[model samples]
Target: MSSRQRRNDSAPQYLDATTLTAWRNVRDAGEVVVSRISAEMENQSGLSLDWYGILLHIYEGGEDGRLPQRELERHLYLSQSGISRMVSKMQEAGLLRREPSPHDRRNVYVVLTDLGRDVFLRATPVHHAAVQRHFGSWLSDDEIASIGRGLQKVLTAEGGSEIQCGEELDRLVTFGQSVLALTSDTVAVSDAILVRDALEPLLLADAARHVTPSAVQDMRAIVARMSTLIDSPEEFFRSDWELHRLLAGYCHNELLRSMYLTLLGTLSSRLDSVVPTTNLTPYLYERLSVHARLVEAVSSGDEDQVAEAAHAHHFTMARTRLVDAPGE
Candidate 1:
């Protein structure tokens, strides 16, 4: 028999039991829970999940409550025609407006209106309850982290975001240089602080101001994991990266996501740097407290408090990092 035919003949025997079960579970869980959550959210708020998602993306887009029309379309996974129709309806309802960018007349921006904000805020609790009841509540924090980590691996293997533009890819390559030259413990604390001090608070504020209900659940899960890992500093910090990544996702800015992930990647090249000296036990406890507070701030939708907590969680600080090379 041809090799292809031979493999096909043996396919049944070669099927790993774990693989079979995992695939089925992933498929079933995603479809069933999403369907139920959609039904519940629509019933309670009269806003379909897709409608809420549009308002959500715009809400999370930035402090200005706007996103470029093309970028918004790319993120929403809708066809050009579908987005046009939805935007028209949302505009009719006073939920959104498509305004030409003053900076660039050719580009239209999707701006969330005050009515959209009210509707989104009103529907948020319903969405959260449904997500928790149907999805997040069923999983332990550790399970949630593990599942997130595994799926992220799959996403990475699959070339991650289809929407990653050339510029984003080019910048991501720069993060790789630090990977080659530095490990976790050797990363300069001052350099990490520079990135964290500036960008981290903004990301946290965005998360607090506009995170989707599903993203909130993920943040809580990571915080729960961090709470349990107060003694295990390395594990705790890895979980911290997960929480920050969740925070960054809600910002709805791909370029910003890249920048934050670069900071996180450089700091967490391995893990040990996050918890250096055993004598720093007090500092570790304090970090856990700050993380818990950050989550609370996010969950409560308190933007200022979220920014404050995130700033308080700043990593170790030292002196300025010298440039080792050009364009670094």
Candidate 2:
């Protein structure tokens, strides 16, 4: 059977509560990584991690390290359709140019443009900080070392090689479970609302009081904090909630804050494959100001101001996102 067919066939396997719960934690952790990174990338150079990955790959894999799309699909573990869409979007964005292979007309190679190279260079530091904050900050020195070995073992095992797992391996698994279990708080809603209210006024005032430049800086600081705690799932989720609540506070309309919070609460509900990978790019970063401005207006406590700011902010963010590379 084809891979897709096999996946479809496996869909109905009975999910025991333990396995289902484990799957949920895994999905939640991955979502935190994606959402936190995407938010930071959007605020930083405006590139999504997927888009950034595409550029990073092409940049590193020029003539010396050139790769075919098929190979890229394997390395990135993206489906054929996913790879195609990413390449197409990057091409349209003028970050890459595709050419038919000299040996096979049907084959194509993606090349990074000069502009794209410049973008990657400019974006690299931001990417580094984002990755460091999201994945780096959470691990202690010992956990970090263990994780490295564990990951190496996984890769080698996948390649038909075996690696010994020490006692710490079990400890890692146990620790991970404990972390996820902590986030299953029944009281999160009331807790979140309380926290949301405490911070909203200042955030709203800050957003309203600042112009675009200051607003972007303020938003980036918040996203940085949000992205830094990925190790402990409970802490990660709490930080994620705090960031959103702050946004709601900045927007200042309790109703609007609540509306956006409700939407964000669904992040952990869906399966991994259900959500499309995002293409973060520079223009997207500039557009985050919309959210900031809206929150600021909401903080001002005027319905007219809230409506006007939210409308303008959301529209601009949506419109610029339309300019994303076509296939992506």
Candidate 3:
């Protein structure tokens, strides 16, 4: 049989009615909830959901009520042009203004105007009521918790992680150099695997030696933050990278921690180049699970378990690059 035929033959033939019904119910319910809330938001506050989200993010960002332009882009899940256009409209409406960063001239900051703040404050209650009425009221406490856990698991499986473009690009360049040295020439699957084998042990060792209860709590918080970003791939990867960086910072041995960070910086950068654009959802999910497993292992403080988890994590990553290399 052809490879495609074999793949088709291997696919499941059927789904049970219960499973189908459950899936349909969830999808339909999501549509209903969003429609109801969005309609209410527009009618009551004269604001689109997008406007509310942008204003809310800015309002909660800090006491100054400012968000970096790039940071706002991540939150809004909009392209630069899209955000710029929206911001322009809002600016004309006298809701917000863009200010150039004092420290970095290239960067622009989005500051909520007094009018924007007033709108946000006024709309908050209406938004909350709509959500509670359309969505929250339907679920009991246990059901809500169960749904949260289930969704988190799905995100973890999808490798939803975050890393800033600028930082990721720098790491990629550094990593490409490291891979060149390790392989003495072209980068290959085995070379990537070898690099992982060499570095993960050091990271696991550091964690075992220095990761504290407080650090574990912080790691969990990062993971929780990551769970929320599954729908935002760019933001997810940036956050995922932040979680690893935070773990590295927890290591008591400064030299070892720095070395591990350098190695990881390179690996992540290299991987970014090779990762396929299509069919990435599954790959991301698996990546998320690996990170979640590593966090749990670290918290357990079992050297053997940590080592095993690290091995699996690095192995899966290396394998992903090998399997998903462009044209492969």
Candidate 4:
């Protein structure tokens, strides 16, 4: 049987159409193309095309890797709260975050976390491969190109243009190289301050206010794990990121998420270069204690309390970092 026949062979005997000659029939036949490929992708990889589409839109839609929730709602035709809730779920999975609009506070923007971006980068290839397996293998490149051009003409009427994920990756790689070139001058403390400021007030405050009960439980579980692993700083830090990454999802602001993540990348890279693991070992208990409190504050659904706790932690951490240590 042909690939198309094999893909959807459950047709009843009365629905006996071996070939699709009409334009409407052909269009209808292609309607399930995305669903078929997405199914294949899910079977092979855990990522679903729906999730991939959201990430793709954000990656392609925004200049600074941020896209408004409103635009997503339009593109996907989701209800305001529908998009809000879906992004919240992805946020819980540590794949996305929310932030208020820089231009309009009433609007929310969706952005990918570092982990979210990484997952997207990995899943896109699996998606392309799945497409080839399910459909591309049957069509020649020329045929595919012809279909693309033909479809573009129709898409043009709707003001849609093609955006390649590969192109976006290339741009990111180039930008990353430029940033890496200046790592010598990047200051960890300064970057940390900028990130902390953005996160503690607007981004995290939003998250705390919108946090669901299940989210709070998940975060507390991560914190509980941290307490057990405090002596094991390596494992503790992993859980640390898990808790914060989960918290990032609650904000529902794309712009804030982007800004916070950018500064954090710089802060993390610089801190890794400047701080030794041995030096960090002495402070794991304090780190765990502070994080436990931070999670509880968020779980309380009190944005003010979260901000206060976060502020106190930062200052406390800074003081510890600044104090001179006697020779070990």
TM-score of each: 0.43, 0.42, 0.41, 0.43
By summed lDDT, the worst window of 10 consecutive residues in model 2 runs over 171-180
Which segments of candidate 2 are over 4 A away from where they belong? 1-27, 64-66, 159-328
lDDT of 4 by residue, 191-226 (tens): 454456546567667788789999988988998898
What is the per-residue lDDT of model 1 for residues 1-328, given as tens digits with 9 covering 90 to 100?
A: 8654575567355655776899899999999998999888766567777887887777665458888877667777678888988888888777788888888887788888766665665455456557768988799999987988888777766655432222211111111101111233322432553676578777777657778788777888888888788677667767877888778778766777788878777666643333133224665567778888888888888767776776666533321121111122
How far residue 291's Cα lies from its native spot in candidate 2, in Å, is 34
Reference-based lDDT, residue 284, model 3 = 62
Q: Which of the two, 3 or 4, has more TM-score?
A: 4
User: Who is ahead in lDDT, 2 or 4?
Assistant: 4
The lowest-lDDT stretch of 10 consecutive residues in candidate 3 is: 319-328
**Relative to the unseen true structure, what is the C-alpha lDDT of residue 192 in candidate 4, on a scale of 0 to 100?**
55
Residues 1-328 of candidate 3 have per-residue lDDT tens digits of 8654565467664556865787788799889888889888777557767777788778765449888888778766689989988877777776789999888998899898876765665455456657767887788999987876766665555663332222221222112112111212222333444564576667776776678898888878877877777666555666776787887786777777777677556544534332223334555677677778889888888888888887766542321111111122
Runs off by more than 4 Å, candidate 1: 1-17, 103-106, 159-328
lDDT of 2 by residue, 42-154 (tens): 66556778887777666555573245676567667789899998888777787777777888776687777765665565455455556667876787989778766755755
Error of 1 at 190 (Å): 42
**TM-score, predicted candidate 2 vs. hidden true structure:** 0.42
